[model samples]
Target chain A: MNQTKFSSWIFDSFKVSPEGLGLYRIFCGLFLLFFLLPSAGIYPFISSLPHTFFQPPPGPMALFDGFPSHSVLLLLHTMLILSICSMTLGWNTKKSSILTGVLLLAIKGFVYSVGKINHDFLIIIVPVLMAFSGWGEVYSVDAFLKRNMQKVEGWVLTLLALFIGFMFFTAGFSKLIGGWLNVESQAALGHVFKQYYVVERQDFLAGFVVNINSPFFWECVDYLTVIFEVGFLLAIFHPRSTRIFLCFALLFHFSLMMVLNISFLPNFLAYAAFLNWTWVDHFIKQKAANTEVKSVKHKWLAPVVIALALVGGWAIIHLIGNDAVLQADWGLAGFIVISGSLPIAIYHLFDQLKRWILERLK
Target chain B: MKKNTVKKIFIFFLIFLPLQYAAVGIIGLEKSEPWPAFILPAFQNVDATPEDVLVKEPVLSIVDSTGVIADAVPSGKLFMGIHESQIQGFFRAHFRDSTRWKGKNAEARSWLANRVNQLYPTADPQSVNVRWINRYYDLSSARRRIDSTRVINEFSISLRDESN
Candidate 1:
């Protein structure tokens, strides 16, 4: 594919609707404000645990007694809240998005070193992409003031799609390391399940599993977890693949919720919103338009698109494997890779499904 | 220049405001010498004592080595019921009816009082009055200097045996 055609394809894939941008800004702004209010002691709420499962060894109880009283922490949180609010309101939206992103990175760095870091840290990518995508063009204070704003192009949406996919891809690759691949690693599963049961006593599914007393059931769970996590990148690259994978991801999370009684599955579901719903719609529309056009000469574009998708998918998976933090948890790292790539997978899957359905109807 | 002016104003207020409040709070704290809440009660010196005394044929004449009458108990065939009621009330007022103390009869309170008197024979029982002291002063500072040469002035009167 020529540079012009490739560039155009990339640009066409990312364009987003005004409504999508508005939704993004609103949710991101609200999330920041919600966390900031509690952090500042303005509204005392049940504090979320800062410790990640992968945190380094136990330290002094006094050190982990509560949130830090440092002035810098307060300043950073205040800045983040203001920036996100401004971005949502569309007042100097681009600058606010950039500021929010930078402040988030700074705060994450400070908190991650002391507290346990979660996969939610990947949400930072949204603001970073929004800063460049000119997402403030719609549903912003700026758009209201200007009265006339150009619609966002496809490239912006594509960037968001890619970012989401990369997140899941990285997570999947991270889990492929160490004893995670072994079918006999029932001990690790037992440990995680026990922790889940203790934290959430209503594990009806887990109780059944425990009563059955079959080692084979545990082995099946162990292999299925690794496969679903590692297969995320493949499942997300095509529409049919993604539909299958989405079911798998959903089932994976649901089973964990039922058996392990973990609450993080809801958070994962929320992040899946970055998938390329627009691309799917575009593919469907384009395929319908192509049916009537005589002498359609864009057959070569299909191969190029496939190759680009593969390369992009492979690159995301590679990045996940290389990430030092994800690699630390050999058993769970594959899930991290799959999680990183989930956004991209969803977007591509939508695009392929849209195109296939449109062609069949024509 | 306008931006610089706004920045300067912000920096000035930010640096000065917290310091001003902090300085005032620290000064107030230092002036108060505020003690921890739990430690305040230890400084209160509340004396425990009672007024009445009973006289009878001395069963045990407890005295210090200098031969001063510190304490004494009367011998038998007395109104044991009335004597016990008074002694039990005295013990209850001082010790709050603790299970550790055996308030069996009049003999128990007398036994304990006699033992205390023997140890400090010169301590005039009449002189031992309950006095409320100022709480602000430390308990260690209120210790009395015992002058061994000085004699106690209070004396016990012997009541005639009514049964005889």
Candidate 2:
């Protein structure tokens, strides 16, 4: 194909409907907000500490010589939460999304200033990009008020897919280069596992993997993990391949949650942004029709259920009150696994129940 | 933000992408290179390395003006919901590196001064000091006892300058 034709094809493929971007925006917002809820108490915690304890990361370090006053930190955190809520609710969404992104970056810098960076950094990038796109053009209050139905450039979703795909691919490949693929010793996974278990001595779930009877089996699985991650890029080539890769990725993250006690739900949700959810929508509609239930009645059902589950889980954890129970090897592992799987399981159950009710009506 | 340009750039980014992290992994293996945040190398062999050279256990204690010693409160208990790693990392950042030890100690001194002031609002302590205990534990041992003698580092702050 000629260059002009190729460019046109690429442009056309990257153009996504307003609904697609809006759905992606919603997923990103929900994942970030939910993950951040538990950390809301951090403001008061920081306030009680000495100002010297606040070692702002490089960017913010340049901006301020000392820690901001307690009132300012509290104000910033409150605004962060409020903006996240506004972004998710699709009210003044574009600005709110941008504000949320900025707040996430600022909070991350503040938290990491003292010398620890975490995996949640990837979560904000997609939302920041969404702010600049046409995501708020549909399935949003702005869209509802304006009656806008314009198609946005599809690059936004594609970019999100690439970030998720490349992130895992990079993680896996990084291990490979560090000699994870070296079969002679198969010590890479053992050492990585030992880092948290032995060095950090903070084991909640991975201790089981550390104590596994068959070392060779886990080593082989580690190699397979690298292969799966490196091979993830194939998903971007086609929808079917992307779906297949996403399934494997979800399983991989679920397994990681069990063994490593780490949950990558934000990455999983970002992966969903790449999928054409028309099929899921059709399924919901068909079920709603059979049951003679207005689908709009259930539109807000998923988010409401998720919020309730999260609040209930937090309350239970607080009531338990034993730090040992919350941080024990088995206890922490179980909590992560249940928390990670529960929402997805509940959503599926709700969908199936809706379908079952419609079938009975038929 | 032109649609055509964005599509082309993304295509370029995905081109030969397997080598992108592969290169980063190679650079990171040496442990001295400045790595871009969020990038990881392919093989990070953590266990095979000798733990004696890599790990140091930090024990913190507070010493009052009269030299009375008391166990420093754990940051996790104080913060009341932070991950264990965050609490550890916060202190580790202060204790681990020798070059920055003084600066970190000065900061600790300021914190201890403020803490003492808060605890004794009626009469602040004349001096408050923080003592850092560094001990190395050999993982290969069955008991995991301290491999070396405990090394003590101390920093003090005076209440006379606390108002400043």
Candidate 3:
């Protein structure tokens, strides 16, 4: 293709359904909520550590000079949890998503301030991009509320894919620079496994595989890693190529998790952004074709009721001051009931209001 | 936004991607400026002969003044059922900087002491020690026989303030 045609093709390719971004947003938010949020419970212990222990990285992260106090940590955690919920449900998504990203970065900064920085940057960047884009326009509470067909520019998804691709390319380039391809130097794949063995974290299977000590096998793995990572950028424009890389990436991550016990769940979920979802979008449209009417009327009632019920229950318990209720585990029950249903209720209510508004406007 | 404008922005960002890697890989700008999110592209696969393998792992022990070891178990395993990488990360940081080792060791000693006190509060405070029983293979031999294990780098920490 000529330059003009190529440029136009690239621009045209960037157009994607907002539903795709919504899917990415919801999955990422859920991953954060389920997998990452619980880890914040350690904030109390982390907060107790002396300030000198935190060797904060330079730039924006440097703001975290010392760990936050327990109360501040708790507050940040609360905000993060709330933000995650809103972003997931697509309630006030633009603001909520931005909040989620900022809070995520803040939390990560505090978490990694001690010494090493974890490679979970994608989880933060993607959401921030979504916040600015039209991600909330479909497959979300925002979409349900707006009651309008919204088409997001494809650039948003393209940028996210490119970010991941760039990351892999850099990773491969970095390995090349570090001489990972040179097997004779003993500083390649074989050496990596040996080091892991020395560190004594090797799983039975990993240990067995590394024990073979076959130079040929080691060389293949070493070269494969570099080639796959460096070549990942090619998958960005080609859907078929993306599937292959996606499978390879998933396998690589799973193997890493199995052998090394390193969990990058957020990054794993972020990979879903690369999917075109043309079929999934069609299926969603078909499914929603029927319910588009009733969904409008009932959106506001459920959330209002759920919120009041939770508050009233809490108030009644406080007024009663019954130790029996406490002993009966009512607190835990209330927590489970509220935390479990609040997101769904909020989403329902937001959608209902959107449809109601749209009806009135029509 | 105009289509042309969006295209221009896309192209600019596309260019920005490689320029970033170049900054990190070639210009060392990322290292000097140290953008918090920008990871310097460096891969490490350290090679070592079988002789470098530690068959017998080291232990960091807390022994009381009366010579009784503290009740604290040496669990270098990962926390919350995650893989060993997390625990390895804790140790890797200590090993990464020789200059900071002493300070880091002291911090670890204090943390361990506090943990032991919580476990066995009645036990009197004591000195902490890191002992390594090292054994490596004699790979040069056809059989690759394991060498006799010997104690190596058995360092002891005596806290000036036992309370710390």
Candidate 4:
């Protein structure tokens, strides 16, 4: 636990190739411009509402008397789109990334002002943290602008994992303290019933999950959720265990999508950092060939491409004609695709975790 | 960046672990902390217990911007699937704030009028009205039976508010 040991541990745990980092950068940009940002329409949608509903929860947003004017909100939304584009292209890495985070924070702050806060912390902060991760060292405008690039530091990825783990750990602990363990009451069932009967979010597998009214099953769900969430933080200290926890996280989020209709798939952006993407780069080698040449060619064209995609995404959202774009949560479909037959994946994850525990015990 | 600087940053990041605990548990600011707090509250409480015959639900009546009055839409429908999850907070705060004028909460009316305006933008004039719907579920397990629901408490606020 000495200084050098701690520093080495931090660096070694998160190390990835420059190409890997570059690919991840592109993945983030594409994910935002396509998957997450189109939903940015919701910000203007909410801001355009009456100011009487602008009562923010206790935060910096509470300082504002009312919602900003449509013009101000439109400006923030515009800046947000541009910032995401800048961060994606790795132009002015640190500044653009920070600006992206700040803009998302400000806008989401306005949204959370409407009497709720969901788990958007990771996605909002990833751009800012990755800026410092030296992700810009390769395949970036910053890198292209420089003759020589310093070694990319891997600490930021580890730091991000720490954050993810830390938040999960707190949530898990809070659940345990908040009576999730009570034998008489089925806490998970309570939530299932609420999301089912009360909220009427009964699309997909929600009806199926609700019918299994076994108190035993609900209790097991309660216990396992706490273990998985809390174990995330503890597992981060062990590289192999961290991978196992991340694997469980995939299943966990998919379960949420199915049972409760909550989508945390956006978390993949942060989790992508913990992966060693050298193999992915190798597998996509045919596509990776002369990426630098293509990137240079696309440098001037990237923003234009992004702008088109943004316009197209908004067009589709408006076409849907309601806020159904927000409700449909197309991102959750990624979970279904990744974890095909979610029940089987859950069983597999549990089996693997049990075997892993038994191996360590032996 | 220098290795020393990286190490210092790492230490600072590590320190965040304790700082967060202090902010949430010790300082007890979990509910108030800026931006991201560990607000993943346990879904401990049931929405409505099977035994509890009556469940309270909010119903909204609104005059659209085009001056069409539609009565008794589920309150959650007002937002039209945008963050339907957070309605618990909205319902609790503006509706059931514990008898400071339980059904007659003015903020609740203003909130509804605003949404009506947003939903039917450019309509001549809109009004907001809301009442409670208490209903019961009719199903039983081996031994447990849930009561029927009937909550039609009248707390009608007619707020004519313009969008700012």
Top TM-score prediction, candidate number: 4
Which tens-of-lDDT digit does each residue in A235-306 have in candidate 2? Answer: 655444555566676666656555655444445556556555434444554565668556544654433443
Candidate 3 lDDT, tens digit per residue, A1-362?
66776565555545566655665566567656654453554676567666656656555767656778978878888999999899877888888888988888887777666555566677788778767666777657877788433456666666666677778877787788777777564344434443344554443245555454555665677788789888988776654455456566766654544444333455654665655544445554555555657553442332333234544654565576622232111232322333343354445446656877999999
Better of 2 and 4 by DockQ: 4
What's the distance in Å from true for residue A317, model 3?
32
Worst 10 residues of 1 chain A by lDDT: A42-51
lDDT of 4 by residue, A1-362 (tens): 87667877787886677767766776677666655663544655576555655657665787887778757878887898898877777788678878988888888787777666666678877888877766666667888898335466677777777887887787788788777777665667767666666667676698788777566787788889888887888888766677668777877877788777766556776766665555555555544455666554443243344345545654664565534433434533444334543554466568777998999999
Q: Is candidate 2 or 4 superior in TM-score?
A: 4
Candidates 2 and 3 compared by lDDT, better number? 3
- Cα deviation at B85, candidate 2, in Å, is 3.6
Candidate achieving the largest lDDT = 4
lDDT of 1 at A195: 33
How far in Å is the alpha carbon of A205 misplaced in model 4?
Answer: 1.9
lDDT score of residue A353 within candidate 4: 77
- Residue by residue across B68-101, what tens digits does model 1's lDDT show? 3533233111212112112322222332323312
Candidate 4 lDDT over residue span B74-153, tens digit each:
66556654455567666655555334233344555565566666665766444555566666543345432345555566
Q: Which candidate is the best by DockQ?
A: 4
- Stretches of candidate 4 exceeding 4 Å from the true structure: A1-5, A38-40, A43-45, A48-51, A147-150, A286-362, B25-34, B38-56, B61-72, B80-82, B98-111, B114-146, B150-154, B160-164
Of candidate 3 chain A, the 10-residue stretch with the lowest lDDT total is A326-335
State how far residue B47 of model 1 sits from its true place (Å). Answer: 67
Model 3 bad stretches (over 4 Å): A1-6, A147-151, A185-204, A237-239, A284-362, B22-35, B38-43, B48-59, B66-84, B94-98, B101-112, B119-122, B130-155, B161-164
Enumerate residue pairs that collide in model 3: A14-A154, A15-A154, A145-A354, A299-A349, A299-A352
